[model samples]
Every structure is written in structure tokens, then in C-alpha cells.
Target chain A: MLLESTEQVSRWHERRAAFAELDPSMRAEALQRQANSIRRDIVRMISAAGQGHIGGDFSVTDVLTVLFNVVLDVDPHEPRRDGRDIFILSKGHCAAALYATLASAGFFSPNELATFMKPLSDLNGHPANTKVPGVETSTGPLGHGLPVAVGAALGSRIKGAPARVVVVTGDGEMQEGSNWEALMSASHLGLDNLTLFIDRNRLQQGARTEETNALDPLDEKLAAFGLEVRVIDGHDFRQLEAAFGPSTTGKPVAIVANTIKGKGVSFIEDRVEWHHKVPSTEQVEMALEELAQ
Target chain B: MSTLLDTAPVDNRVAFAEELIELASHDDRIVAVCNDSVGSSNLVAFRERFPDRLVNVGIAEQNMVGVGAGLAAVGLIPFVCAAGPFLTGRALEQIKADVAYSQQNVILCGMSPGMAYGELGPTHHSVEDFSWLRALPGLDIVVPADAAQTRIALRQAVAEPRPTYIRIGRHKVPPVSPETNVLERGRFALAREGSDATIIAAGTEVSKALEAAEILAGRGVSVRVLNAVYIAPLDQQAIAAAARDTRAIVTAEEANVAGGLGAAVAAVVAELPKSQRVPMRILGLRDFAPTGSTDFLLDHFGLNAAGLVRAVEEVLNGD
Candidate 1:
């Protein structure tokens, strides 16, 4: 059952308190387990809906889990609180992963997950900020989130609020000139409160990112734009936590999170066709079994 | 209608900037976001008055719009301003997804819209803004007729917690309506009242439309004139009434005939109970304009008083 009402948002505090009791290694392990469950939910969500970007979901699941469970100072109840940290999913194709993570984080009722992409459901293919709690902005088109995050960070600075704005984009998604445009402004304005995580899963819709449009030397490119760059294993919770940690100097942080397109399911891992291809019933069962292990 | 008042030409951007600064004075949450368009957008005074509140995102329009959305997300009212072409053409997707689709309370000010760029050519002219923005859902597109209306539009957009786009004119225009005219959302004021025919005009074309009305009045053909500032949530009541009471309705705009005010008014008049509908004529640019001044282009496209009178006469004669 999902925590439905605003009053039950204290569930976040309880989860935080419980996680605080655990040691560092245990905390990482606990987050890993949470991510594993969320991954299972992603599979079920897309499978039931008969359509989704499952590969990107599996790739970004660990990052979303870490952000919501560990780093972000947000309450599902007061999602619009002036001081709460804001998260934007720029690679909106991975809405399944974001929805599963928000549901797991007690932003809304988990039961609502079953209604995703259905007629009149709040959980569309792209997350809408107005419909879904904890969703700061609606994004389906690529390369929009980072610029908005820059503005949000600026807003926080103007208000003297300590809120941090974080955004996640895809590796293929970086080829869009808008992201670079935002990168320039983000650095020029010195938005230390903004952080960007690129889900560098190597593959795009039909081919490898390099084959489609080269994004290698990604860190150098980001550093050239004056951002503090860090390359980390996207699937590893420890590295994610550290990368999402303190800023380097007064510049914005960019994490080129290296990841496989499909991290958990062995059969589908790194295969270009699985970018948005749904698994067969038998394949679903097999993927579920692999996840169970 | 015989007596005419001489009014000085005023840049709507001045009123827009002044009103914005006035609003920002009391409300610190209001921030001005522009893409290196401070001088053109008339935000120099605003920036000087409140340095921290003015966010110049450089020449990145896409980033400017997205950043405006981001600012609104965290409870700041960002008035995103830029040259009309770049603001609408370069960053249309950001405006769609970040501001409109996400329901961010960001005010997008399209500075120097229509053929206001004059000799700069079609590349700089934002003649397609109306057609492009009218199709987007959850966006209130306002094209203020003159300086006072521009001030009202800015104030209304800031007060209302929703996404709105205002086309602030760089071209100077004389006041077409009284200063006491109550500028409501989606409502138009009657600039001149005549039951014989009605000329519906918006933005910079409004003053010219009134001049056309005066020209028709010289021939003893009375014409009603409506200043259509609110384009998206158009005043259907006024449009329907015009169709019912007037012998003909001629719509004019400094935009394209494809989907601007002409198209909007036609759509309304088409669905109105058939008997009440009158003969209609739409006037606007049909193609990319030739290299010339704003006035030259307006004359070349047949969008001035003479062109409007010709259209109204044609509609009247045809019917």
C-alpha cells in the first residue's frame, strides 16, 4: 500500500530516521535493496502497460533511488515547500523509473503505479509536475531540465534558501545544443547549488551514442564549460552518494554516470533493440527471476 | 467619430519595463530573465534598479526559457524576455515543455514582435509568433495594443499565477483606447462603436485599424473597431456580437493570416448560429516579407489603413 494522504508524509521522516541508524556500508546495502525492488516495479509497470523505455529505467534506477532515499531534502507531503530540494527528469522517457522511485519514496500511493499510461491516469509516459506529487516539472522533450534547474538554483540563491536543484539527462540527450547552452549559463552564473547527472548508458534508441553522435570526452567537454566534472559508476550507490555530495569549489557539478543500458536483466543488457522494446511474457518471467536472484 | 485626438507615439517596452520594476519593488520574488536582450527589451532600467533580480542568461534562449521555468518551480516569478524571434523560434520546445506543459508560472515577454525589426528581414521578425503560440495549451498569449495596455498586461500576468506570453512592442504606437479602459484577461475594449461594420485589430495594427475606420467614415460608412489584445482566450462574445450586429467584419493583425487573430475570429464567427454570421475578411502577411522598413513592409503586405479599407470594401461589395 502507498502512503496516500499528506498527513502520512511523516513516513519520510521515519524512513530517514531508520536509515540514519544504519552504518555506512549497511546504508549502501539498504539503498541497493530498495533499488532492486524499484527495478522490479519498473519491469512490472512497463510490462503491464505494454510500452515503456525499460532499458533507461533500469540504468537510472540506482541514481533515482540514491537521490530520493539519501540526498534530497524533500517531503512528499509538502512537495512545493519553498526550501525543499527540486529534482527534474530531463530524459523524460525514463518516467517509469522516476514514477517507481517516487512511489517507493512515499510521494504517492504505490497502487497508482498500476494505472500508469492508462486513460485518465496521472502517470503518463512523461511525468507531469501538476499531476504527480514530488514532480517539480513536466518533461518529455529532451534537454530542458538542466536549464530549468539553473533557474531554480538562481531562485534559491535570490531567496537565500539552501535548496539544491538536481537534474538527470541521458548520454544521447546531451547532443542537443540546449543542454550546452544551459551548461554555459550554469557555469557563468556560478550555480554551486545545481547538480546534473548524465545517465551515460552508451546506447540510444537505435545505436550507440558515439555511432549516432559522439559524446565521448564528455568530462573534458563539461570541464571546458567550467563545471566541476566527475565520472562515476551509475549503478553503484556509494559512488552516487559521493558524487551527489559536497560541491568542488563554487561551480556546478556534473556526474557522467557510466552505466549499461540494461544493468540487471542479463539477456537484455546493452542490447540496442531493448531501448524501448517490451519483453515477451516468457522473457518477462525470466527477467523477473534474474532480478529475484 | 469626426474628432481625432493627437497622441504621442510611445514604445510599449518602456511601460512593460517600468511596470515590471514597479511590481518587483514590492515583490522581491519577481525576477527578470533575458537572453542578452537587456537593451532591446528595455530592461536596462530594471537591471539598474534591481541588479540581483535581473538574470541575463547570455545568448542562450533555450536555456533562458528553461531557467525561467526552473526559477518558477522554486517559487520565483521570472519574467523571461528576449527578442521575439529567438524567444519563440529558438526555444519553442522549452516554452512548451518547461513552462506550458509543466504549468510553471513564468511570464514570457516576446520583445519587438511582428515586423518591428524593420530592415533586419524575416530572420529577426517574429511574425509567426501568434500562429505558433496559439496552438499551445495552457498558455495565455497577450498582444497589448499600446503602452498603457502593455503595462496592464504585464501587471495582470505578474498577478495571475499562470503561464502567460506578452508580445511587447518595440515599435512606437499611439494609444488606441482610453486610459480608463479596464484591461481584463481575454477581454477586448471597443475603440470605436459603429454598427455598420467592425474592424478587429491587435498589437501594432490597432492604431492603423482605427485610421482605416476613420477613412471609411469619410465615405459615410460607419465602422466599429475592437482592440484585440488577448489573443488566446479571445473575447468570443464580442466576436459573436459583431457578426450578429455588423454588416461585415474585417480582422487585421501584424502577424500571419494562417492562425493569428484573423483565423481565431473566423473560427468563432464560423460556429456562431449561421443567420447571425456576416461576411468576413482576414488581413495579414501571407509570405515572408521583402527587405524594407517596418512601414514599407506593412504597406508591401497591404496591412495598413488603405489595405484594410480595400478589404472591408471588397467584403461589403461581394456580399
Candidate 2:
């Protein structure tokens, strides 16, 4: 029932190749279906484990889908290949979503999803780069990913490598001043190769981002920090694709991905209490059914 | 490793920068990152020679450390230089998560460590770096005794890439360690050998401990001195042997007595075979220092040669 390590690697490569070679017209639908399937996997994994941030996972699923299915140029066998585009999940609390995406995209076996946060699991609560493939850097603490992205971008530039770096952070996580510091550095270095996505789900752990700490005029604030800011509906494939393109402003790009927490299921979406709450058995069935539809 | 024949006192920061520049010149993967501490970290010449390689991330310590980790993630060996207080105190979480837990190939160069920032007071003093960094697993903490050790430590870090922190002291220190003995990881160098008493020291305090040993030798109290190179992976063999062979011991460091070279040696000594209850003394700054120079601060807190001699004598005679 379990594939060997080499078999698992090849399986992911085949899956990734299939999706990567899909027809241009069918790209959006394929990404949506993959995202929907990954969502179901996340719901099951967290429900079985009884511990996870399912709300943020639901909110940030689409961008991750587009990244793995479309934007990024990475290989499961050679995750750290020279001149490969790097992607990091700065809001690492939603690791279930990342694991699901990586599994579906063929980085590893989908069977590994059962081991999420289980005993001796490589899938830690936060994304650890050393343990996980396709994770460029370990990021769990707020404001960590942007600086790393800046550094990677600079490294690529200095080495004459055309590799690009893309990092996603939670809107609630942006209140950390370190992100601003990194923004300053990225702008100073003129890292056009770096792209930052702020999952603007508007909800933090306890309450709303505005109620806890206001990040109003988020786009303007990013612009002030010398980034090329773009606001888009986070779940829209077309908009995400447009915003995720190469930076024309010759500055670091920042996309405020306006989204609703717990986006897919009707009951969970826009609710504050579902930030990390596990659904009961009945709720799990309902959520999965809703995601399937 | 280059041989050191100069007996004149030298600042380890100078050697650190020179060694970094030399290493970076040959290896294009080697880069430097700082938080607007280029001047303070003595990286002016490095920045000049390799302008494109020195990444100045303004005055942000957390970002500086995270950037260092990121660069290392991309296969570039980064020597992240910053003032010791800010690098260790401000960006501790980054150091813990990014470098230590993740095991990034980062060489964190903590410049001007300990009371080297003397008159700036406790706000700028990094006396707690040992205790703070020692708690993190997989992060190697090295405190080189002099200029030669500083250069060797840098080369060793590059030779065997891992998450490491090296303390580059600002205080001027005379060379005490010779070039003959290999710089082994987690092993203390025998600075002076004797059988009557032992003094364990690191960083700027190694020279002071040697001076104290000479005075103790004149008083008919032969003293053994150990330069504690690796603070985290402590040389337990040397520490246990010293405690077993010597009548008394004194641990000195340019750090707090609470948790540093002294605390590390004590922890090792506590695990020794139960028969040897060696009387000991830990000489370091016990409280926040007053307005003074580095020498004044060391003498004020009883960390000078005379103070170390007195502490060793008391431990030897009291037992």
C-alpha cells in the first residue's frame, strides 16, 4: 500500500508533469478542481488529527493552487535545483493546506497526509524547509518570509540567476514590524524577482485584523514601503494569475489578496471563531460535501 | 590557518573582517549581511571591496537575521555581522527558528561582544548571549580567545558549514594561543599547563587569566589555564581532567557570572565522578556596570588579573 521513496518521488513528478502540460484553456478549471480536492484532503487530515488551522487553510488555498499548478518552476526530485523559482509559506500555521497542495502536485505521496502533525511526522505545525520538499525556507514566525524572500532575490541577482521568489503572509501577520523592515530592505535592493502575497482574510486568531490592529489602507502602506501593490479577489484564478506576473515596476510586488476566512464552506466562511476550531463529525461531512460541490 | 608571530595586542574584529574578506574573495558564495552596522561591525573595507556582496538591511536586526537564513537556504554561506547585543537580544527568535531549529548554513558573527560596549551600559551589553544561545539545540556557539583563533574560527565555519555563532570581541587582547595545536571543535586549548590550580577563560579574558596564572605561579601556586573555544559544545574532557587533577579552579569570562563560560564549566564539573569536590570560583560581571571604559568595567567587577589571582588563591587555600 505504501510506495518506496523513489516511487513516491516519481509519482509526484508524473502528477506535476500532467498538470503542467495541461491545455491552456483548461488550466483554470484544473486548478480549481485540484484546489477543491486539496481542500477535502485538508478537512479530512485536520479532522482525523483533531488539531489545525483549517480556516486560514481554506482562505489561502487558491493562491497556493495557482502557485504550484501554474506559476512556480520546481521539481520534486530536485527541490533545490539551481535557478528554480522559490515559494515559501510565511503564514505556516496553515500547513495542512501546503501539505495537501504539495501532495496533489506530486512532491510526495498523498498517503503522507495521514501523518500531518502525528507522532514523528515530517509535516510539522509550521513549514520546515529541511523536512519538507518544495518549502524553500522555514517560516512560522510573522514577518520572517519577506526578509528571506528579499535575501533569496538578492542572492539570485548576485549570482546572475534569473530565479524568482514568491512568499505569502497573513494580513493579520503583517502587523509585525519585521515585515516592514523587510519591505524596506527589499525596496532598497530593488528586488523585482521577489513577489509577496498578503492573504487578506481580515481575521486573526482572536478577532478581525482591523479590530485587533488596524492595517487599513494596506495597499497604500505597502506602496509607501516601495512595493508595487495590487489588490485582487484572492479566490479568482484570472486575477491571481494577472497579479502574480513579473514585476514591471522594477520593485518588489505585493498583492493584497482580499479573501474571507473559511472561504469555501458556507457555515465556516467569514466566521471569527473558526480560526482554529475543529469541526465535529457532522460538520466535517457537511464541509466536505460543500467543498465537493 | 595562518601563523601568528605578532606579540602586540590586536583587536579580534580587525582579524574577523580581514579573514571574512579573504574568504569571500575566493568563494563567491560567501556574502555578508548587516543591519546598518557596516561601520560598527568593521566591515567598511569588506563593503568597499565587495560592494555587491554586502547587504545592508538598514537598522533592522530581525530582518538581517532572517535574510541571512534565506541566503543560506539558497546555498550561499552568509556571515551575518551585527552588534552582539542587537543580534543576540533583538533577533533571538529568528536566530532560534531560522538558523538553529532549521539548521541553516549561517555563520552569525556577533561583533563587539560582552562589556566591549562598556560605557553604553547594560542596555547595549550582551552578557546573556551564552545563556540565551546555549538553550537552542543545533546552534554552535564559539568564543575565540584572540586574533588567530578568530581567523581560524571563521575558516572552520566555512570549511564545515552549519548554523554557528562566533563572538568577535572588540577588546584588544595579546595572542596567547599558539598555531601548533589544531583548533578542534568542542575542545578547550591548554593555554598554560600546571598541577596546583586551574583557570578556565574565553574571549578577552583569556589573556587576563594567563597574566593571573603567571602571578599565581610566582606565589608557588602552579595554575593550569584553558581557553574555552567552543562555549556550547563544551570541552567536558578538559574540564573534568582539570577539576580532577588541580586542587582549585577559577572560571573567568567577559560575560555575566550567571551563565557563560563559568556556568558552562560548572555544569560540566557537576557531572564529574562524585569523589572530586573541587572548590571553585566564577569571576565575571555580577551586576550592571557603571559609566567606564572596558578596562575600568573589567577591573570594577573584579575580572582583572589581580581579582582572578585572589579568587584562585581563596579557592585553593579555603579547601
Candidate 3:
């Protein structure tokens, strides 16, 4: 009886270790399927709610997908895990994508996606940190995430911990002078552990970024501000994975992810009207079909 | 009155720095984010002690507040110190977005609030801070009356993790509360007690309200004084009780009349029971103050003891 019990314990331990050793490639593939499902769900939710930032949502979906799936060392069950990586969505209007991603990553019930903008729901028009389990900070206004990311990075460093801080911001949101101020401080402090990803959709609320306020020399600007800049196709998962890895330079990294607004759905791609425009029933069905494929 | 030996009066800003330094000594999470106002904020010692902790983000007020919020996001207790005018006016959007809406645990220390820099003109005066900041939700607005209150408020601010704005007054103020008096949020300090009328004040005007009460007492007018430390979460209970017991109420603040302490009191009094309702007179800047010395500006704006006494008398006569 003792020998039989010993054999059973060893078998359980081997299975546990094997599950823990799952490769990143396999994890990324699982996350990709989840991301596609999340995108489909976002379209349905926005369509049902009759209001949402669809363009930015579609643009940042893949970015959030990779972070929650591959890069971040976090457990949804322990959302506030002390040693876990900190992820702040600075451009809070893109909350539809974040909410979907968090839900898929098991931060909350996937059914909660149905309550995106319902009155009195924990999920509101914007992501509120106090209400949401996975949300690190409440953000709606632009140019806020970077600084908080820097602080989180600094705090981790203060405690002599290996946890990293990542903040995703919209390119249009960077026009606010606050982002640069944070950039300067992050560089000055040499916050190598922090990574900033800009969802460069090349469009703002009213017009194209170039027409509204040109950030043509964005890479140069970030470099001048002392960050090690890396330009990537935001929707490309492989490139995002490489860019988000541990930094070598003793300075903050800015991944200028080139993205198309209203990605995945062809009709609304690069359109300004879709910034916060909820799709009709027909459009939602079409979006779901496109994401499903 | 008999002459007493006058000691060098301590500035509340120094007290603010001292308390912050003390907190930082123990808590590694305590970080100071500033807009290049180390000397002005009296954080030179704080910077020297914790060089790594002091984040001087140049002269950009908007960025300073944003960075402070960011620091708070990572589980760091950030004390964002800067000139009141620049901190509030320059970065009003950041305060609204990152600090208030985001609900970051940031201690926004508004150095030298009110018309402290009188000769510097209207642009420098933080008269609109109370109104502008009070309008935002999930933020605590603290205008400390003296050095002791400044220390207590700063300590309490860190202990209670929330978005808080501390208006550190530049104008000299005499300590009104007892040494043992613990500063509590949304609680008014009874500086003096009487029955005929009540004087409500905050920041530098608290001491002036006390002086006004003494002057009114000599003139056969029984006056009560209440020090309003937390302006946003106004001590409604104390205010309602004062309005109920007294025949008249007078509110004094070194801020604008539109949305400052006076406006807050007026809103509460309007909702009070008709039997307990009393006549109220608000004393504050009605228009852009003219350029002059700090004392001259306070007198001109009717934020002095004489102004409070006059406002109380007007309320009494009207009632």
C-alpha cells in the first residue's frame, strides 16, 4: 500500500511540472485564438451597448493579447500578485479591448463582457481601477499611463524586485505635453524595467495625426527624450513579443507600434468616424465574421 | 495685553517638508515628485536625504502630476510638490484625468497657496484652487490652518491612500488648535464658542476668524468660530449645528466667492430646516485682486479679522 501511494504522488508531481513548463509558442497560439474571440465579443458588446471606441479597441487588441498571454508573469486568480508584472492601459478609451483581453485571460468571468457599458455595472464607459479586478489604474484622459508606469517601475526597483511595468498609450494621446515630461523622468531615472507601447493608429478624434498634430519624428523625439525606441507593426504578434522582452539598455524602452485604426474589420479601417462609433447589427455581424476568419 | 517674547515663526511649508522627510525615512515607497520647486517647497533636505526618491521632473506641472500618478500606480506613495498656481492651473487637466478620475494615491502639496505672492499679480494667486479642485470627485482638499495642522494633515494624507491636495499656505498663521488635537477629516475645530453668531473660516483666515470673534465679544456680540480644514468634504454637521444655534453665520476664506468656502456653506444652509436657518454673509475675493503686499491684499479682499467682524455684524443686522 505504501509503495502504491508513493508512485501516485510522483505521477502527480510530474504532471504538475509538465504543465508549468509549457512553451511560449504554445501559450501565444492559445492566446491568439482567445484574442480573436475577444475581438468578436468586443464587436458584439459595442453593438449591443450602442456606443464604444471601436477603432482604438481593434488597434490595441493584439498588443494587449500578447502582454496578457506571453509577456506578463501574472495569475488572474491573484490579480494583485505582489511580484506580478504591472500593466496599465493609459489610453482608457480603448477599454473595450482591455476588458475583452482581461476577461479572456481569466481575470473575470467571460460573461461579464456582456455588461460593458450597462448602467451601474462595474464596467463603465471607461476602465475604473477601483471597480475592475485586473485594471491597475482608472484611465480615460490621455497622456496619463506613461508616468504611472514609470512610478510602478521605480517602485519595483526600490523593493529590489524583478517585476516589470508596461503602459500602452494611443499615439494621438501623446500630443499632451505630460507624456514627454514622464519620458524625461523615466530616462533620467534609467527605468529599464518599464516599457511603453504607443498604439500608433495615425489618427486622432477629428482628423489624421499628421493633419491634426504631426508626430512624424516620433522615434527621434522619444530617442531625444532618452528612451531606446523600437518601431513595430502593432498588430504583428511576433514583433510585439520581441520588442516587449527584458531591456538590455539601462533606459526605458518605447515601442512605437505602427497600427491601423479599426484593424481586422476592413470597412472601418483607418476611418475617423469609428473612433467611438458603435456598429449596427449588419456591421457587427460582418466584424465577427472577419475576426473569426 | 502684556508683551510676550516673540519667537521666529515657522513657515507651514517647512513643516510640510519635515513631516514628508520623516515619513520617507521609514517607508521606502514614499517618493517626492516635483516641478523644479525644491527650494520653494523647502524639499532641499528631503532631496539630499533621499536623492533616489525625489523625482524632479523639470518645470512641467502637467507632467509632474502625471508622473506622480504613475508612481502611485506602481504602489509608491508619491508626494507631488509645486507652487499652488502652477500645480493647479497649469496641470488642471492632469489633475482631473490622472489623479482624480484615475484615483491614484498621490499627495499633491500646493506650496504657497492663496495670495501669498501678492506682488506677483493675479496669475500667481491660487484663489481659484478651492473652487476648481472641490468640483472634482474622489479628491480630498485640505487647507491647513498652521504648521501643526500642516504636519498632521501630511501624515494623515499618506496613511489614508487616496487623491489629496494639501494647500500649504505661505502667509504666516498663528497656531489655533491645541497640541493634542488630532486632525480629523471632515471635522471642524471649535476655536471659540459663543451664541449670537458663528464665524466659519479655513487656511490663513482661521486665525483671523478667532481674532474677529474676540473683537465681536468686546462689542457685546457673542460669536462662535469654526476652523474648516477640509474644504471639499465640508464639516456639514458642525456647520448645520452652528447655523441652528446661532442667529447668523459668516464664512471667510482667502479664495474666490463663486465656489470657495462661502459657496459651500451657502449650499448647506439652503438645505437646512427653516426653523434653524440663519442669515449668512460670505467674505472672499469678489473680483481679481489688485497688486499689493500680501497683508494689503488680504485686507482688501476682506479676509482679515476686521473683515470677518464686519461680515458678522452685517449678518446680525440683516437678521
Candidate 4:
């Protein structure tokens, strides 16, 4: 009811034609190629914008690509599809990754990524659902997306819709008490259809996350909150796909994706200063080359 | 002298609950969200009627509001009910970003607003909500004065698709406006008409302003009382008319004077031509209230009917 039916049908036709013929291996290969392309786009977006949270963006790129390309049942042309899966980037500072992945998935023209942070641009420093077609909600101040995702999951249940809610959060963003509150409710409500991906890059804006606030032993904390916790290498597309594959049981699943900050680029990976720092022209080329390889 | 207790009083919370339940019965997408405020918000009946629709986020104001925004995003109308202070003060960022800035159609029902939590102290008082929320862009702030207005406002808010904050009064108040008075967005009806001076009041203070108007009438000082239901999209025309037509203007509310109704009225009057401008007096809490009951605190802050009369007299005397 929220979306136009004609637009949805056309978009669904395109998506079905794109994926319906592909076998599982071909789909995985296509998604892997999309992830590399998204990483290159993230580098270009941050470099062109002159400032962005590239570190977390690179850290979350593969996860975003995997979800958008293969996992989430979403239509780019009809972003407001009621029965489609919902994805919220709770750690919204890494909007470059989300925007690039969404664009690569055909939500909008990939050329629009150049408008990131420009005046009157839909691609602001944070993702705004009002301006952007595919963004579920506007998020930037950290620890917001999870709760909204929880609400969406609950809403899907109430409506008896076959939609799944997925929220991607940063490891450092977990320090926000709101996420803990959401974790409590998501477990209490037994939202088996909900999945939260914590991009555990271990590096915050200022310094290492452990030095900042110490979110180690995170799996135990997640398990304590009554979630079915799984730790996976975020860069591994196969692992990411398996984790997001199916609901194991009653409780919701929280996947702690152990990812390196600035994953694809050799010089930028795991570097604290790369948090929101833009890559120089030469550095951008270097990153592109690394991703291309 | 007739006191505030003389008139038969009704709780706006009950009216809000009833109207919400009625609205939800017809619209399946209407959901009630609260942060462990089921009892305080008088949502027991709503929960009982629509158990599946009520989302209790449990002691987390931020999550509750965010969840409300998410629900709105997914095409469900979420009425986020919580105590006034916590709803406005605690989860303000979520209210600003998720609901207001995101332009989500979430109805924020601030329960027990103003000094309703009287003996519970200043921490619980939602006195600064108007000031805090009024600054946000694209958010409607509605403070319904009585039960009838509460019913009307809730029904209207449910029908319209926009982010709104309705302060439902826990304090008892007699219906001040007649059933003929139509309630709309950014419009206020004249509860009492007089040319001598104009008195504007919102929320629980409207009844007190009416009583003050009666008192002023007995003193041969005809005063017009404007019930300010919509605070954000203020009736600038009505406020400007008050300055142009009346000798003086007095703004009153059961909230902080700094950035609330008084400040809103003052801003409008200041923008008018000098000829239309008149001396204005603002009556409300200037600081946090000390320990006391709701009545005691109202008296302590000069928010009673006598307070409006005194403020009007001060503005009239031009002192």
C-alpha cells in the first residue's frame, strides 16, 4: 500500500529477470564483483567529497554489498515495497558505503554518488530517507538504526508481512545505551526474523575502540542479551551469506562481523587516522588499484 | 472567590486513551508505543483492546521514540506515549532526527505534561517541552487544554500524516470551550471575547485564564481569553490582532516562560508595526519549582487565575 503497484511490478520484473536465471554460484560471483565495485565507489565518493568516514565505510562495504546484491529481497525501483526486507544502517557515519552499495544495486544512478555532501544533495554526510529513495530512515548520531529496525520487525509481524529487518551497526556505536535497550526488546519479543550485523572494525574515530571504551568480549555480551550470537569474518562473502541465510530458532541473531577498518586498501586498513579522513588523489588511485586487484 | 476545584474536572489522559482506541479500531495501522509508561499514560485500556498493536519498549525513551519512527517509516502510525519530561527531554535527539527531521508520521503523546508530576519534583515536570520542541523544524506541538480538545486533537493527529507532539494533561480541567468551537492546526478560538485586553493561555493554564477573565470582568475590566491549543504553528494572525485590537496582552501557560507560549506571543507582537504593539506581560514558571503539590506549585509560580489577572493588570498599568 505504501508503494505504487505499477512501479513495483516493473521493478520486480527487472529484478526477477536479473536474478531468477542465475544459479547459486553465479549469484555469489555476481555479488562478489559488486562488493569490489562498491569498495572502489566508496573510495571515489570519499575522495571526491573531500571528507567522509571511509574507514567504517570500507569496513562495512562487503556486508552491504552482500545484503543488497544477494541477500535482501528489495526492489531498487520500488524501495517502499511493504513485503520486502528492511535494512537500516545504524552506524550512519559510514553512509558512503551504503550509498555506493545501494547505487551499485540499481537503487539510483551510480553517478549520483558524486553528489555526496554537496549542497542540496540527497547524499548528505548521513543517509536521509526523505531525500534518498532506498534509505529506510535517517541516521547519523549513532545507535538509532537498531531500535528502528526492531520496530520495523515488530511491525512486519503485526502486519503478517514476509519482510525481514536487518540493521548494520558499528562496533564502537554499541557503546550507546539505546542499542542495549533494543537488544533487550528484540530478544524479549523473540524477533526471529530480525538480524543485526555489528561491523566490528575495532577502530573508532579518535583511536582504537578498546582504548576508547573496550567493547571486547562482545559475543558474550550479545549472548547475555538473549540473542543467538555468531562471529564471522565480515570480508568473507560466503560467511556473511551463511550468517544472514536463515533463522536458527526463536531468538534474534546478532552477527559480530570481525572486519578490519579500511578493508580493501592496504595503507588505510586498521589505521586510526583514516576514520573520517579523506584519501589524497594518489591515495585514491592506490585504493582503486588495490580493490581492482 | 471560586477556586480551580469548583468546576467539574475531567482528565485529558482518559480522553486521549479513548480517542486513540477508537481511532485504532478503525485503522489497523495505528499502534501505541510507550516506554514503560502504560499505567501513567493511561494506555491500559488501549493495550487491553489492541494487545498486538501496543509496543512497550520498556524503560528506554530513546529506543521507544526510534521504534516509533521506524514504525512510521514502515507505514504504521505510531503514537509514542510517555511522561512529558522523558518523552521531550530524554529522547529529544530521536524525536528531532527520527520523527521531526526524518518527517516521519509519528504522533508523540506526552502524558502528564507540565507540573502534573507535582510532588515527584522538577525532574518529572515537562515544563520545558514547549521551549525545547518548538525550536525543532517540521514538528507540530499541540497542547490540548481539556478533554474535548484532547479527543479532537488526537483524532485529527491520527487522520493527518505528520510528526506531532500532543501534551495530554494529567491535571484535571473543566471544559473551557463550547462544542461549537472548531479545532484545527495553527488556529486558536476565542474562549472569551473582550476588547480591554487579551490573555493567551495554553494547556492546563487555559481554564485558569478563563477564570481570570471572569474575575477581571467583575472588576469592569473586559479581557479576551485565547485558548492556544497549537503552539508550534502559532496563530500569528490572532496574536497580531490581540496586539492591534487590545490595550495590552498577557500570555500564560503551565510551562517555562523563556521559550514557550509567552515567548512565542512576544515574538509575534515584536514583529508587528509599532502602532499595533502594546506592553506585554508573560506569566509562567521562570525556574524549577520547589517541592509541593500541583496546586501549590501553580500558586508558587503565580500560574493560577489570580496570576493572569495580576499580569494583565501590570500590562494595563504599563509598569
TM-score of each: 0.97, 0.96, 0.93, 0.95
lDDT of 1 by residue, A1-293 (tens): 23445434566567677877888788888888778888889889888999999999989999998898789988887678779998999999999999888877678977888998889888999988888888888888888888888888888999987578899999999999999999998899899989999999999998999999999899999999999999999988778889998687799999999999988999889999999999889988988888873
Say which docking band candidate 4 falls in.
medium
Q: How do the candidates rank by TM-score, highest first?
A: 1, 2, 4, 3
**Best candidate, lDDT-wise?**
1
Worst 10 residues of 1 chain B by lDDT: B1-10
After TM-score superposition, the amount by which residue B318's alpha carbon in candidate 4 deviates from its true location, in angstroms, is: 2.0
Indicate the docking level reached by candidate 1.
Answer: high
lDDT minimum window of 10 residues, candidate 2 chain A = A1-10
CA lDDT, every prediction? Answer: 0.88, 0.87, 0.83, 0.87
Q: Kindly report which residue pairs in candidate 4 clash with one another.
A: none
Residue A118 error for model 3, in Å? 1.4
How do the candidates rank by DockQ, highest first? Answer: 1, 4, 2, 3
- Fill in the DockQ of model 4: 0.76
Q: Give the winner by TM-score.
A: 1
Q: Looking at candidate 4, what is the lDDT of residue A125?
A: 95
The DockQ leader among the candidates is 1
Pitting candidate 3 against candidate 4, the one with the higher DockQ is 4
Runs of candidate 3 with Cα error greater than 4 angstroms are A1-31, B1-9
Q: Report the C-alpha lDDT of model 1 over B1-319, residue by residue, as the tens digit.
A: 2233257888898888889989999998899999888898889999899999999989989999999998898888999999999999998998888988888999999999999998999999999999998988999999889888888887787777689999999888888766666687888878899878999999988888888988999998889999898887889999998988889999989998899899999999989887988889999989998899998999998889999999989998898
User: What lDDT tens digits, residue by residue, belong to model 3 across residues B1-319?
Assistant: 0011122345788788888999899888899988888899888999899998888888888878877886777678999999899999999988987889778889998989899999999999989999999899989998888888898998888788789999998787767775567877878878788899999999888888877878888899998888898886889998899988899999988888999998999899999988888899999888988989889999887888898889888889976
